[model samples]
Target: MRHGVQLLLVFLVLVLAVPASVSASSEGGHGGGDSKKKEKSEKKEKGDKKEAGKAENGVITIGPLVVNILSNKGYRFLRLEMIVECADNEAAERLVKADAKEELILMLSNKVADNLLANSGKMILRKELIDLFSKYTGPDKVKNLYFAEFVFQ
Candidate 1:
């Protein structure tokens, strides 16, 4: 009788302990996976904010036209701000006299200027733009373009 009682107690303890151990291990594994996903999402958010700041600072002026070109996957938009920089002060004076705002908007709306953006050939197109801009304005004047806000339907 004594031996049978001891054996039953041992069996009960083993069954309970095994399930507790399994549940603890499973919960820990799930927690680790969740943390990793959260970390990845946080990093992505930080990168996006940095890109936006860079885009905001990318404003440039040529003659009397202030230009902020946003390059997206398929298209680009030139946001005109205020006239600031020019090749020559006299050219700046002429542009200011000629109503540069209207001209800039018209040129952008009509797509008269080259897009300098490509869909199927992104890398090659980027390299081409860099090369072209460098020839005219030197490499230091040209940098990469980014789309701060993008919407696709």
Candidate 2:
């Protein structure tokens, strides 16, 4: 009778302990999963912010302008056909009216801006022109710039 009671007590203890252990392990796993989900959501939000920033940085457009400039070295002249993106449509129109190619050559020769490749140069020139135009307009109106077509000779 005593041995039977001892065996019953041991079984009861094991049953109780097993449920507590399982509950503790399940809670821990759930907590870890929740933390991982929170971290993933935070990372996704950061990625979204970066994408928004990039979108806000510039506007893209096509161009059919001929830019003729005398190079820094007096003997060489570069003629380029380029596609440009402006911070805004106003800037784009201004660029067209001012003849960006001519302005770029003058700006580069005068050291106001650096000479760059067809694509990069157009982007830089677009920004520079936006800044120039913003002086007459307002900076809040300007965003970013890009280039779609560029040809250099």
* Clash counts for the predictions, in order: 0, 2
Residue 36 displacement (Å), model 1: 2.5
| Local distance difference test values of all predictions, in order | 0.45, 0.51
Per-residue lDDT of model 2, residues 84-116, tens digit only: 344655544444444553555565444312265
Instruction: List, residue by residue over 50-70, the lDDT tens digit for candidate 1.
Output: 331112333433332334444
Candidate achieving the largest lDDT: 2
Q: How much lDDT does candidate 2 score?
A: 0.51
Which residue segments of model 1 deviate by more than 4 Å?
1-32, 44-49, 55-106, 112-153
Relative to the unseen true structure, what is the C-alpha lDDT of residue 124 in candidate 1, on a scale of 0 to 100? Answer: 49
Clashing pairs in 2: 57-144, 83-149
